[model samples]
Target chain A: MKKILNDPAAVVAQSLLGLAAAHPDLLRVTTDPAVVSRADGPRPGKVAVVSGGGSGHEPLHGGFVGPGMLDAACPGAVFTSPTPDQIQAAVSRVDGGAGVLLLVKNYTGDVLNFETAAELLAADGVDVRTVLIDDDVAVRDSLYTAGRRGVGATVLVEKVVGAAAEAGADLATCERVARAAVAGARSMGIALTAPTVPHVGEPSFTLADDEMEVGIGIHGEPGRRRERLTDADGVVAALLEPVLADLPFAAGDEVLLFTNSMGGTPLLELYLAHGIAEQSLVDKGITVTRRLVGPYVTSLEMQGMSLTLLRLDDELTRLWDAPVRTAALRWGA
Target chain B: MKKILNDPAAVVAQSLLGLAAAHPDLLRVTTDPAVVSRADGPRPGKVAVVSGGGSGHEPLHGGFVGPGMLDAACPGAVFTSPTPDQIQAAVSRVDGGAGVLLLVKNYTGDVLNFETAAELLAADGVDVRTVLIDDDVAVRDSLYTAGRRGVGATVLVEKVVGAAAEAGADLATCERVARAAVAGARSMGIALTAPTVPHVGEPSFTLADDEMEVGIGIHGEPGRRRERLTDADGVVAALLEPVLADLPFAAGDEVLLFTNSMGGTPLLELYLAHGIAEQSLVDKGITVTRRLVGPYVTSLEMQGMSLTLLRLDDELTRLWDAPVRTAALRWGA
Candidate 1:
C-alpha cells in the first residue's frame, strides 16, 4: 500500500507527537499508554467525559479531546481496541471530583476493554458510567460486533453528550443525553474502495472495478450486499432507505442529517450526495432542521460516504447548538 | 472514476447546491453565475476579498468564504478556470464601497481570467486590485503555470490577507499584505498516487507501485523528479529541504507551519509528517509560532500531502491569530 508513513508499527505514537506539537495549547499527549487529554488541568467538580477506540478513524475520539468534547482519549493502534490499561490511564488523567463517563462504541473489543477499565475505576472509588452507541442500521451483527456496530452517530453523541457534561451536568445527566443520542440515531454507508491498514500493507478486501459494497463497516468488513456501482442518487437512496425505514421517521419529524465521507471521497462528491439526501428527506415530509456534511467518522482512506439521521427533540437541538471547540468539531466559543 | 457523483459535468453546480443547503447561515450561493458569498450583507466600507479558481481543490476558494475571510468565491468546473463572467458576478455580489481585492493563483488561466474580470470591473468604475500567489518551490514553470505554481501557501495568504482586509485595511494595505505573504511563503508536495478528474475518468498522472513524485503540483503536473517511495521521514526531508532553501529561512525566524493532506491521505499520516517537520525546524532554531494542519487545500482524492511555511512578522501573526469563521478554517471566532 502506498501511504505517507514510516514503520507501520509506530504510526499511533508518532502521530500523537505530531498532534501534540500542532496544538499544544489545546492538548497534552502522553505516549506510554497513548492518552490525549486537555492541556488545561482537570476541573475539581465537573463531570469528566472520556472516549476512545482504534486509530484509523482520525479526528474522532482523540481530535475531539478538549473542554467541550472528550476530556481524554485513549487511541489504540489502527482498527484495534485500546488495552484496558490505556483506558485506565485516560481515566486517571481526566477524573475530576464529580465523576467519569465513558462513551464506548458497540464493537465487541471496545465494549470488553471499556468494561474492564470501568471495573478497575470502580475499585479505585471513581464514579464512572458507560453509554454504548450502536446506531448503524446496516446489520444486527458483524465481524467485530455483537450487534449493530456504532458508526457516524458516535460523533453526534460525543458532541451532544459532551456539551451536557461541559454545562456542569452530573454523571447521570450525561449518561441520559448519550443514551438518547444513541437511540435516536441510525447510519448506513457504501464503500467504493477499501482501506489498507498500515501493518497489513494491502487492502483488507477487494472489489471489482464496477462493484460497490453497501452497508460496509468501518474496518472494511463485508456489508449487506455487493452490486454494480451507480450514480450518487442511487447510492443515496440505497443508504437512506434503510436508515429512514429502520427509524421509521414519519412526516413532520425534524432531524439532524449528517452526511459523512468514509475517507477517500472528496468533499465535492460528498456534498453532492448530501444535497440528494436533503432533497429526499424534504420529499418525505421530514424537516431537516440541522445538517452536518464532511468526514467526521471515517475508515482509513476508504472511498465512500455514510449518512446518519438523528431524530432531534428540543433538548437535543439545544445541546447540539451549544458551543463546542474541539479540534474536529468547532463552533461557537 | 469511482466517485460518488452524477453526471460528471454537473459536479460543480450540484456540489454548490449541497454547500448552500449545508451552510445557509454562513453562505449565500447563487447557481447562475456560481458565486458563494457571505449570507450577511456585505460591509459597505470594508475592502471585499474575492477569490476563485478550478473546482477540484475542495475548500480552497469556496470553503474559505465567510466572515473575516473571502467576501465571495467563484468555483469553476474541475481543473478548469472559472469564466470572467462568473468572477464579475462575484465582484458584483460582494463589492463594497471600499473596493475589491481579487486573489489569483499563478496559473495561466487564473491570471488571464482574473485580469479580464478586473478590467471589466474597472471599466464600470469599480476600484479593483489583484494579488497573485506564486509560492510553490517546485518547478519554475509547468503545464498550466508560467511561474512557480501556487499550492498550499494560497491558503495561508488567504487567511492572513483576508483577516487584514476584514480589519478594515484599505485596498493598498490589503494588497501589500497579500504580496508580503506571497513573497514570504514557500511550499513543496509529494504525491504517492495521482488524482482523477471526473470528466476524464482517469488519474491525472500515474506512478509505479514503489515510486512517488516529489514536488508534485496540486493538479498532478510533473514535479521536480520521480523517485522510489520512501519512509515518512525521508519524504518529510525531501519536502522540507526544497521549501527551506527556496525561502532561505533563517535560524532566528518565527513562522507558521501548515501541514496539508492532498485529499486522500489520512490525518494519521499527515500528522506524522508534521511532527517530523516540527522537530526539523526546532533543530534549526526556527520557532513555529503558528500552525495549521489539515486537508484545507486538496486535489480531489490524491494520496499524498504538501508542506507550507509562511515567514511571519508581528502583523501577519496577529492577523493569523484573529477571529475568522469559515467552513474549512475556524478558530477564536
Candidate 2:
C-alpha cells in the first residue's frame, strides 16, 4: 500500500486530526466520536444538518461540514460505517434547538446506525429527522447494500439542503428539502480499477488492463458487468444512458449536471467526461442549468468517474446557488 | 494504461471544452491556441496576470483562470510546454491597457516560450514583465529543468501575485510580489509510483511494490534516490527536511504550509500528510500562520505528494489571504 498513512487502522482518526489542523476556521473535531462539526456551530434555534458514512469517499460527509453545508459529519473507518454513538454525538453536538436532520446514504450500515441514533435522540426529546439517499442507479442490491447505494448525489443533497437549513428553515422544512434533493438526484459510476481499503493493503478487486466495471459501487461492489474499456465518449454514453433512463430524464428537462471523479482520475479526464455529458444532454434537448465537475465524491485511489443529474426546480436551484462555506464545495458566499 | 480519455492528443482540448462548459460563468475558452480566459475580461486598466505551461497539472495554469487569479492561461499538450503562439494568444487576449505580467515556471521550455511571447508583445509596445518561479528544492537540475524546477509553489505565486493584480497593483508591484513569493517558497516531492503519460501508454517510471522515489520531480523526473517505503511521518520528514534546509528557514518564521498531492492520493492520506508536516514545522519552532492542504498542483495521476513552505511577511500574508475564485482555489471573495 503506497498510501500516505502511518497505521492503516488509524487512518480515519489521524486524517481527522490533520483535517482539524488544516481547517480550524471551518471545523472542529471530536476524537471520541470521530465527529467533525462546524467550528462555530450549534447556533441557538437554528436547524442543523448532519451526515456520516464510511471513510474513503472523501469530501463527502466530512469535507462538507461548514456554515452552509453539513453542520457535522461522523466518519467511520475506511469502508466501514460509523457507529450509532458516533452519529448521536454528531447530532447532539450540532443541534441548535430548532431540530436536526440526518442525511443518511441508503447503505445497510448507514441506515441502521443513523436510525439507531435518531431513535436514541428522539427518546431524549431531541427532534430529529432522517432522509435516506439511495440515488445510485447502479445495482438494485450489492455487497454492502440491499438497495441502490448512495453515491455522487450525496454531495448535491448536502449542498441543497444545507442551503435550506442555513436559511433558517425549520426542521420539517429541512427534512422536506432533504427529501426533495434525495428524490431529484440520481448517480451512476464506472470503475477502471478497484479501491484499496488501507488495512486491506490491496485492491478490492482486480481487472485486466483493458477492462472496466460498469455501474460500479463506491466501495468496489460488483457492478452490472465487466466490459472492455471504451473511449471517453462511449464511456460517458454508457453511464449517461442508464442514468437518464432510470430517471426517465427526457427532452426539455433541466438539470444540475455533476461529473465527478471516483478518485484516481484527474480533472483533465473528469472534465473531458463532463463535456461529453453536456453535449449528450444538449443533443437530447436537455438544458444543463448548473454544473459541478471534480473529485468531490471519491472512492479512495479508485480510477473512475460518476455522472450525477439532479432535476432541479426553482427551490433546489436557488438553494444550490446559495452561498456555501465548506472545505470542499464553496461558491457565491 | 487505464485512463478516462478519448484521444491522447485531444485530452487537453476536450478537457477545456468540458471546462468551458462547466464554468461558463467564470471562463471563456478559445480553442485556436487553447487558452482559458476569464469570461469578464479586460477591466479597462487592470493589470492582468497570465501563466501557462504544460498540461497534466490540473488547477495550476488552466483551473486558476478567473477573477482574483490568473486572467488567462495557456495550456500545451501533456507535460509539454505551451508553444510561443499559445503564449502569445494568452498575452494578447487578457492584456488590459494597464499591462500583463507573465508567471513562468522555471522550466526550459516554459521560460523560452513565455519569454518569446513577452518580448514579441514588448516590442509591439504592450507592457510586460515576466517572473520565473524556481521553487522546487528537490534537485539542482533534472529531466526538464536547468535551475530549480518549479513545483508546488507555482500555485502560491499565482495566488499572491494574482491578488496583487486584482487589487489594481501596477505591473511592477505585481511582478515584485510574484518575485517575493517565489523567493520565499520552496518545495520537495516524493513519488511512490510514476504517472502514466496518456500518449506513452506506460508508467513514466516503474517502482517495485514497496519502493519509493525520494525528492521526485513532477513529470516523473527521477529524484534524489529510491528507497523502501516509510510511514506518513517519515515520508513527510523526508520532504520537509530538504525544503527547510534549502531555504534555511529559521525558527521564528511564519509561513504558509502547502501539502499537495500528486493527483492519485485521496484526501484521507493528503490531510494526514499535512498534519505530520504541521507537527514537524511546530517542532522546528516555526509558526504556520496559513495553510493550503489539498491536491492543488498535480502531476496527472502520480501517487505521491509535495510539501511547500512560503515564508510570509506582512504584505505576502495579506496578499495570500486575499480572495481568489478560480476553478480550484477560492476563498474570501
Candidate 3:
C-alpha cells in the first residue's frame, strides 16, 4: 500500500502523535490509553461530549475536539473499534461536575465498547449517558453493524450537541438534543474505488474499471449493489434520492445539505456534486438553508462521495452556526 | 478518466458556478471574463491583491478570495492559464485607486498572460505590479517553465502578502514583502499515482506499483528522479533533506512547517508525514514555531504529499497569525 506510514502496526499511534504536535493550541494527546482531549478541557459545571470510531475517517472524532465541539475523542486503529479502557480514560479526563455524554455510532463493536465504558464511568461516580447514531441508509444489516450503520451524520451530531453542551445544558438536556439531531439526519454513499487497509496491503474489494459500488459502507463492506459508472449528476441522483426518501423531507421543509468526500475525491468534484444535489432538492420543493461541501467524513483514500440531509429546526441551525474552532471544520470562531 | 464531471469541456465553468452558489456570502462570480471577486470589493485606498492560474487547484486562488487574502482570482481551464482579458477584468473590478498587485506562479503561460494584463491595466491608468513565485526545487528548467515551477509556496506568498496589503501597506511595500516571503520559502513533492485531467481522459503520467516519482511537479511533470517506494519516514526524509539543504536553514532559525497533500492523500497520512518532518527538522536544530497542514494547494487527485518550509521573521510570523477569513484557510478571525 503506497501509504505514508512508518510501520503498518504503528499508523494509528504515529498519526495521533503527529496530530498533537501539529495542533498544540487546540488538542492534547495522552499516551496510556490514547485519547485526544481539548487543550484546556474539564470545564467546571459544563457537560462534556466525547465520540470516536476507526482512525481512518479523519477530522471526524479527533479533529473535532476543541472548546466548542468534542471534549475528547478516543480513536481506534484503522477500521477498528477503540477499547473500553481507552473510552473510559477519555471520559475521566474530560468529566466535569455536570456530567459526560457519549456519541456512539451504530457499529456493533462501537456500541458495545462505549456502553461498557459508560458502565465503568458510572461505577467511578461520574454520571454518563449515551446517544447512538444510525443514519446510514446504505445497509440494514452488515458484518460490523446491526440495524443500520452510522456514517456522515456523526459529524453533525457532534457539532450540534457539543454546542448545546457548551451552552450549559444539563446532562438530560444534552441527551435529548443529541437524540434529536441523530433522528433528523440520513446519509448514503457511492464508491468508485476501494481503499486498502495498511496491514492487509491490498484493497478490501475489487471493481472493474467501469463499475462502482452504490450505497457503500465506510469500511468497504458490501453495499446495496454494484452498477455501471455514470456521470456526476447520475451518481449524485442515485445517492440523494434514497437519502431524501428515507428522511421523507416534504415541501417547505428546510435542510442543511452536506456533500462529503469519502477521501481521495478532490474538492472540485465535491463542489460539482453539491451543485447537482442542491438542484435536485429544489426540484422536490425542499429548501436548502445551509451547505457544507468537502471531505469532512472520509474513508481512507476511497474515491467516492456521500450525501447527508439534516432536517433542521431553528435551534439546530443556530447551534450549527455557533463558533467552533477545530483542526478540520471551523467557522465563526 | 474516472472523475465526477458532467462534461469534460465544461468542468471549470460548472465548478465555478457551483462555487459561486455555495459561497454567496463570501464571493461573487463575474461572467463573460470569469473572475471570482470578494462579495464586497474595491475597498477604497487599499491595495488589491489578485492571483490565479489553472483551475484544478481548488481553494488555492478561488477559495482564497476573501477578507485578508486575494481580492480576486481568475481561473483558466484545467491546467491552463487565464487569458489577459480575464485578468484585466478582475483588476478593473477590484482596483480601488490605491493600486493592484499580481501574484503569479512561475509558469510560462501564467507569467505571460499576467504580464500582458499588467500592461493593459497600466494603459488604463491603474498601477499594477507583479511578484513571481518560483520556490519549487524540483526542476531547474522544464517545458512550461524557464526556472523552477511554483508549487506549494504560492499559498504562503498569497497569504502573507494579502495580509500585508490588508494592513495598509502600499503597492511597493506589499510587493517587497511578497518577494521576501517567496525568497524564504522552498518546497518539494513526491507522487505515487498521477492525476488525470478531465479532457485528457488519461493520467498525465504513469507509475508502477513499486515505483514513486520524487520531487515531482504539480502538473505530473518529471521530478529529480524515481526510485523504489519506501516507508513514510524514509520518503519524508527524501523530501525534507533537499528542501532543508537548499534553504540551508541555520541552527537558531524559526520556520513555519507546512505539509500539503496533492489532493488524494488522506489527513491521517499527511499528519503522519508531518510528524516525521517535524522530528527531522528538530534533529537539524531548526525550531518549528508554527504549523499549517492540509491540502490547501492541490493537483486534482494526485496521490502524494509536498513539504514547504518558510523561514520566518517576527513580521512574517505576526502576519501569518493575522485574522483572515476564506473558504479554505481561516485563523484568528
Pairing residues by index, what is the TM-score of model 1? 0.99
Q: What are the fnat scores of the candidates, in the order listed? A: 0.79, 0.82, 0.63
lDDT of 1 by residue, A126-146 (tens): 999999999889989988999
Q: Where is model 3 more than 4 Å wrong at Cα? A: none
Tens-place lDDT per residue, model 2, B7-60, is 997889999999999999899997778999999986779998999998899978
Give the lDDT of residue B178 in candidate 2: 93
In model 1, what is the error at residue A159, expressed in angstroms?
A: 0.6
lDDT of 2 at A117: 91
| Rank by lDDT (best first) | 1, 2, 3
Model 2, position A297, has a per-residue lDDT of 86
Can you tell me which runs of candidate 1 are displaced by over 4 Å?
A: none
Worst lDDT 10-window in candidate 1 chain A: A324-333
Better of 1 and 3 by lDDT: 1
